[model samples]
Target: MSLSAHGAEGAITNALTIDVEDYFQVSAFAPYIARSEWDQRECRVEHNVQRILELLRQHQTQATFFTLGWIAERYPALVRAIVADGHELASHGYGHERASDLSEQAFADDIGRAKKLLEDLSGKAVLGYRAPSFSIGTGNLWAFDCLAAAGYRYSSSIYPIKHDHYGMPDAPRFAHQVREGLIEVPVTTLRMLDRNLPASGGGYFRLLPYGVSRWMFKRVNAADRQAAVFYFHPWEIDTGQPRIEGLDRKSRFRHYVNIDRNYAKLQRLLGDFSWGRMDQIFLPDQQAGAAVV
Candidate 1:
């Protein structure tokens, strides 16, 4: 679990991550889509992930896939394909529940289940975990203790912004050791106008113009000189996925804004900056532990 910067002499290698979950599983849609209804919904994750893999292949980039245990159990081959294509297979917990909502023991069980499930499927030690909707914060700092006890070496679960739903604005903007064995790599952000702006991707990446996103990331690299952690979801690229009804206006806008144009923007992003897996950038000494299975 030793850490060292892995960027080249003049270029910083940013961490590119994908949260592998279906569109129906978004935290905002929880009120509309019940967990029991998850099985009845048409699964698009397999196809969407295939497209993502092809996109990464075309760019010749490797990334970290924070895959859900639910998705992995159902789409085991998809997980294998990600590993076979040389990406890091990390856990996104088992059920997509927010860490802040779970008791420490419940959170521990969720992470443990996901780590074992992902490792059993991919034959790699699952070293990373991202909470659903960036749900880990000051209120649930014990989640880090759970992660460490569950054998996770790092977490990308904290979003350092002032958001209505999830963010710890005062947290470190870059990776830092939060516990004895675990590192907390908050998603990339830009400090501006005495406030932290969301630059790392997700809804913000889609909401802002491509130029704005690009400028923010470039600033982080040139000004901060730190490896920026950018994340997106498989569902973000699936414009054809089934739409959920009864969503409030804000939820609808946040989930579907500019999704049709996201894939192309992602291509531009891949070409614009250097990208690599999370562990390779942040935990340079640890191998991804890829295995054939």
Candidate 2:
């Protein structure tokens, strides 16, 4: 779809996304734990995702799962289960490598492999892709071209806020056509004091009071009059997962803070607003009548 193809419709329905990676696979933990040890670490993602599925079921909500191709290969049944439950199955690339870290060809191969693997597993056209950690930005705008070449219709790969790890502070906050056929729907942010504040999910959602997060999303809906894009990982809600030892205080705090309360907080979020898959909300042509939620 082109830029002119997208239109703002009434009845804003926010895009709810899940980055389906294990706790050990988080970008922050990459320094402490090597990718070779990923297979050795106790795999808790299956259980965690099942819990997430149940939670969404209770709330009668549907979401986009930007799942890792690595996980899908090991747990094909889980991929089938997500499709069986009627959720959109998207790609999180083959491995969780940041697009900024890869050569264009390597990035192309990664996304291509993941897209094919996911489509084969789910027997559905995988139309969306999200970078490992929102790693696509001005430096690697070519990643958008790669995504379009790989046949992905949309990408939620950029975060508009400034961050030490990954963000393009000057990027568009709302969905925009970054390539001929691909849309870059960045995660939500709130404009405050002349800067983009992180209003969507991730560590911020866990660190702040649930009320604050709710207020931010409401502000985006009522004030900005735009549907918000929120995201989180499965491991975030698992308080009992084994703690990684000998980590920097910053990484430790960012990963584990408020894990005990996040699940309940997420439950409240589901009830507070309307949510739907990325394709339904952004690629309206693929999901006609979805604009009204």
Candidate 3:
């Protein structure tokens, strides 16, 4: 749909984007071990994604499911299941490689492979992407142009925060346009002490009390703005999954923190906001809602 259709409307409906992958597959923890090790155990992730699909369907909500191409190719039926439920199928890359970790050409190739794989599976245009770990920060801004050239309408890779890894400290928290005419939907953040912190979703959604998360979204909407684009992964709700060994104390904390709170919090979010597809959440003068896993 054209932004012109909602040109003057205030506070666009919120978007709920689910990155349908296991938490173990996230790029943050990938450096601790060989991906081939995780590759050996795939069924856990598959089952977790299936569970998310059923949950969203039960809520009667349509969300954007940014799926990894590796997962899509292996679980073609899962991709079909998402589309069958009227959800958006966006690329979450072939594997969980960080865009910054890959050279521009390599990132392009990765995204290209994922786009082709996902489109072929869903039989629909996959016009959106969310980098693993929000890895497409300032250093890899070139990735945006690559996405636009690859026929992607939007990306949600620039997490506007000050983390030790993978955040653009100066990036906008709201959606905006980028070079090559591609729109960049940045991950959400809140102003804290003049610095924008990542209270957008994910671990924060799990870490913060439900009241905090609910109030933040309500605050953004009350300011006459669109509801913030929120995201999380299926593995987040599966607290029973086996934890990886060799991860640092901090990595373990960030990954495994607040696993059980995710499901109930998500249900609260669905009840509180009218979630829409990412493309529909695209605001005029800004871009689409790009989220992560």
Specify the highest-TM-score model's number.
Answer: 1
TM-scores vs. true structure, each candidate? 0.97, 0.95, 0.90
| TM-score: model 1 vs. ground truth | 0.97
lDDT of each: 0.91, 0.90, 0.78
Top candidate (lDDT) = 1
Weakest ten-residue segment in model 3 by summed lDDT: 1-10
Tens-digit lDDT string for candidate 1 (104-159): 99999999999999999888888999999999998889999889998888999999
Kindly report which residue pairs in candidate 2 clash with one another.
none
The lDDT ranking, best first, is 1, 2, 3
Pull out the clashing pairs in model 3.
none
Q: Which candidate, 2 or 3, has the higher TM-score? A: 2
lDDT of 3 by residue, 218-292 (tens): 776665365577898888889788878888888898888889778877877888777777776673443333332
CA deviation > 4 Å runs, candidate 2:
1-10, 287-293
Cα deviation of 93, candidate 3, in Å: 1.0
**TM-score, structure 2 vs. true:** 0.95
lDDT of 3 at 96: 82
**Candidate 3 RMSD to the real structure:** 4.2
What digit string (tens of lDDT, one per residue) describes model 2 on residues 79-169?
9898888899999999999999999999999999998898888888899999998999888999988999889889999999889999999
